[model samples]
Target: MKRLNIGLKEVQGVYDGPEGKLWELIMGEQIHIGGFMESMVMAKKAGIKEGQKVLDLCSALGGGLRFLVKNFKVQGFGLDGTKTMFDEAKKRAQAEKVADKIEFKLGNVLDIPWSEGTFDVVWGEDAWCYVTDKDKLVQGAAKVLKKGGTLAFSDWIEGPAGLTEAEAERVNKFMKFPYMESGKGYEAIIKKHGLTLKSSEDLGPHFASCIDLYIRMLSEQLTFDALRIIGDNMEMFKGMGGEMAFMADLARKGKFSRGRFIAVK
Candidate 1:
C-alpha cells in the first residue's frame, strides 16, 4: 500500500475539531461500524471476563472501554493521542460513575507507557487505521500483554479484492489514514509477533451497509445537525458526503473493508 503524508497531527486535528463531532453525531459515541453490537461480538470472541485488565489503543471517547467496564466488569485503561478525546472520555467516565474502574491517558499508541505484561487484553476498535506504523502498534500491544493474553480489534482494511494505488491514496487522504492493511497483512503481523491467530474475518459487507446508513443519516435525518457540527458549511458537508459515498462504493465492491481479528500472545 502507498502511504499518505497524514499522521498524528492530522488525525489529532480531526478529532479535536468539528469533524470529530460530526462523526460522533452520526456514529454515536462508539464511532465505529456496528457500534455496540460490534463491541459485544468482539468481547465475546475475545472471552473478556470480570476483573480482567484491558488496554484500549486509540480509545476515542472511551466508548469501548466503558462498554467493557459496564458489561464485562473489566477494569479498562485507555490511551489516545488527542486531548479532546481524552478529556471528554474522562468526563464521560466520571458522569457514568465508572471513573473508578477506568483510566484515561493522553498518549500515542505506538509508544504505550505501560510496562510489559501490564494487561490481560489489548484491544482496539476501528481507530487503528489512523496509525502510521501498525507494525510497531502490534508490537507494543503484544509487549504489554501477559503470557496467554489476548489482542483483539476490528479495523478498516483493504478488502480481499484490494484497492489500486490510486484508490488507496484517495481513501487514505480523505480518511486521514496513513495506510491500510489487508486482513492477511494483519494476520501476518500478529503471527510475526508470536501471537496465536485465533480468528480473522472480513466484515466488508457489513461495513458497506453501515456506510449506507451513515450516508442516509447525513442526507436525510441528520442533515441539519451534521451541517451545524461543521459550522453550517454546506460545501464541506456535501464534500464529506461525497467522500463517504465513494467509500461506500468501494466497500460494496470489496476493495475496502472492516477486518476483525483475535490473537493470543
Candidate 2:
C-alpha cells in the first residue's frame, strides 16, 4: 500500500483537539476496540507477570497501561507523541490511584527514549495505526525489550483481501493513518528485528462489529454528546459519520481490519 504524507504532526492534531474527545466519547477511556476484555486477553497471552516492566507505545490516555498495572500488577511506562493525551493519561492515572505504577512521557515512538533491554514487555493497542514507519516502531519495541521479553499488541491493519488504492487512500485520510500494515508485514518486521513471531490473528469480523457498535452509539445514543465535543458542528459531525460508515463498509468486506500479534525477543 502507498503511504500517505500524514505523520506524527497530523496525529497530534487529532488527539490534541475535539476529534480526540469524540473518540473517547464513543470508545471510552481505552479508545480501542474490545477495550478491557481485549487488553486482558493480550496480557494473558503474553504471559505478563506481576512486577514485570512494560512499555506501552502510542499509549493514548494510558488506559492500557493503567489496566495492566491494576489487573496484572505490572509496572507501566507510556510513550505518546501527543501532549494532550500524555497529560490526560497522567491525570487519569493519578486520579485512579495508579500514578505510582505508571509513568507517561511525551515523545516519538520511532525514537524511544528508554534504554535497551529496559522492559519485560512492549505493548500497544489499536493506536499503532497512527504511526507512519511501523518498521522503525517495531524495531524500537524490540530494542527496548529484555531477553525473552514479549511484544504484544493489537492494531488496525490491512485485511486478508486487501484494499484498492482508492479505498486505502480514503480510509487513511479520514483516520489520519499514514498507512495500515498487513499481518504478514508485521510478522516480517518482527522477525527482521530478531523477534520470533508467535501468533497473529486477523480480527476483521470483530473489528467490523466494533465499528458498527460505534456507529450506533454516535448516531443513536451519543449524538448530542459527540456534537458537544465537536463544538456542536452538525456539518462536521455528519461528515465524520459518513467517513466512519465508509470505514465500516470496508471493514465488513475484509479490506480493513484489526490484528492481534504476539512475538518474543
Candidate 3:
C-alpha cells in the first residue's frame, strides 16, 4: 500500500501559502474539502450537536475542528501525524479563543493515542484519502467511539466500480490519495464492525466547482508568487493544472467523487 507523502508540513505549506491563505479566508472553516457548505450540511445531518466530545482524525490546522466547536458547540481534540500542524492548530485555536475547548495531539489515525470509547464522535475532513489502509482507519475510528457514537467524515472516493489502476496512479500522484475506496467498500467495512450506515451520498459536482475555483484562484491570485517560490517551473505548473482539470472532469462525470459518510457504532 503506497501512501501519498503528504505530511502535516506539506499540508500546512499549502494552507499557509499566499494563495492557500487567501483560499481559507474565502472558503471559511471547511478548508480542504471541496464543498464547504455541503460538508457542513452533511455533518449536521449526522447528528453532531452541542457539547459533544469529538475526535478529529487527521486534522490539519484545525479548520474543521474550529467549525465543529463553533457551530456544534462540540469539544474538539485534534489528532495529526505532524507536530508542526498540531502546533499551528493550537495557535489557531488559541487565536479563535477556543483554546480551552480544543486539544491537539501528534498521533496516528490508525493507532490513536487516546483510550477507547473516549469520544462521542469521530470526525475527519478530506484528509483521510492520504491513509493507506481504510479498514484499519475505520476500525480505529470505531474503537475510540462510545456505543452509539457517531463517525462522520467527508472524503474523496473512487466511483461506483472503482478506478482503474492507471487512473488511480495518475490521481494519486497529484493528490496524494493512497487508497480511494468505493461506497460499497465503506459500507461493508462499517457494517462489519456493527456500525449502521446512516448515509452515504455523492458530492462530485461540488468537486467540479471547487477544482474550477482552485485553478482560477491559482491563476488570478498566486501564479506569480507560486512561480517565484517554485523557480518558475512552467512544466510543474502545467502538470498541476492538468491534474486539477482531470479531477474536475472525472468528478463531474462520476468517475470519482467527494462523499459524506455517517455511521454509528
Candidate 4:
C-alpha cells in the first residue's frame, strides 16, 4: 500500500479547519463511527474498570475521554498533534466540567511523548487512519501501556477484500487518509506488537447505517447547516454527496469498514 507524504501539521489543519467543523456537524462530538454506543462496546470489551488510566491517541476535541470519564470514571490523557486540537479539547473538557478527569497534550501519534508503561489502557477512535506509519503507531500504543494493559479502539479501515485503485483514490481524496489497515491486518499488527487480541469485529454494518443517516441528514435535514460549514458553497455539496454515497456503497459492500479491536499487552 502507498502512503501519503503529508505531515502531522497539515493533517491537523485539515481537521482543525472547515473539514473538522463539517465532521462535527455530521458525526457529532464523538467524531467516530457508531458514536457513544461504539465507545461503550469497546470499553466493555476491554474491561475498563474505574481508576484505570487511559491514553487516548489522536484525541481530537477530547470527546472520547469526556465520554469515558463521564460514564466509566476513568482518568484520561489525550495526545493530539496540533495545538489547535489540544486547546479545543481542553476547552470542551472544562465546559463539560470534566477537566479534572482529562487532559490534552500535543504530539504526533507515531511519536508519542509519554514515558513507557504510563497507562493502563491505550485508546484511540477513528483518527489513526490519518497516520502514515500504522505499525509505528501500534508500537507506540504498546510502548505506553502498563503490563497487560488493554488496547481498545475503533478505526476506519480497509475492508475484507480491500479497496480497488479507483475506490482508494476516491476515499483518500475525500477523507485524507494516508493509508489504512484491515481488521485482519490489525490483528496481525497487534500480535506483532506482542499484544493479545481478545476480539476483532468488522463493524462495517454499523458504520454503513451511520453514513446513511449522515447523508440523509445532509440532504434532507441539515442541508442549510451543512452548507454554512462549507462556507455556503452550494456546489461543494455535490462533491460531498458523491463522496458520501461512494463511501456508503463501499461500506455496504465491505470495501471500506469500521474495524474495532480489543487487545491486551
Summed backbone clashes in each candidate are: 0, 0, 0, 0
lDDT of 4 by residue, 1-265 (tens): 6665666767877877888888888888898877898889889988998999999999988889998998999999999987777898999999989998897888888888899999999999999988888899999999999998999988999989689877886787688887788888899999999999999988888888899999998999988998888889988988999899999999999899988899989
The C-alpha RMSD in Å for every predicted model, in order, reads: 0.6, 0.8, 3.1, 1.1
lDDT of the structure predicted as candidate 2: 0.94
Residue 95 of model 3, lDDT score: 94
Give the C-alpha lDDT of model 4.
Answer: 0.88
How much is 86 displaced in model 4, in angstroms?
1.2
TM-score of each: 0.99, 0.98, 0.87, 0.97
Candidates sorted by lDDT, descending order?
1, 2, 4, 3
**Per-residue alpha-carbon lDDT of candidate 2 for residues 1-265, written as tens digits (9 for 90 to 100):** 7899998999999999998998898888998999999999999999999999999998999999999998999999999999999999999999999999998999999999999999999999998889988999999999999999999999999999899999999999999999999998898999999999999999999999999999999999999999998889999999998999999999999989999999999
Order the numbered candidates by TM-score, best leading: 1, 2, 4, 3
Judging by lDDT, tell me the better candidate of 1 and 2: 1
Which runs in model 4 stand beyond 4 Å of their true positions? none
As for candidate 4, its clashing pairs are none
* lDDT values, one for every candidate: 0.95, 0.94, 0.77, 0.88
Error of 1 at 253 (Å): 0.7
Better of 3 and 4 by lDDT: 4
Clashing pairs in 3: none
Specify the poorest-scoring 10-residue window by lDDT in model 1. 223-232
| Top candidate by TM-score | 1
Candidate 2 vs candidate 3: which has greater TM-score?
Answer: 2
Preferred candidate (lDDT higher): 2 or 4: 2
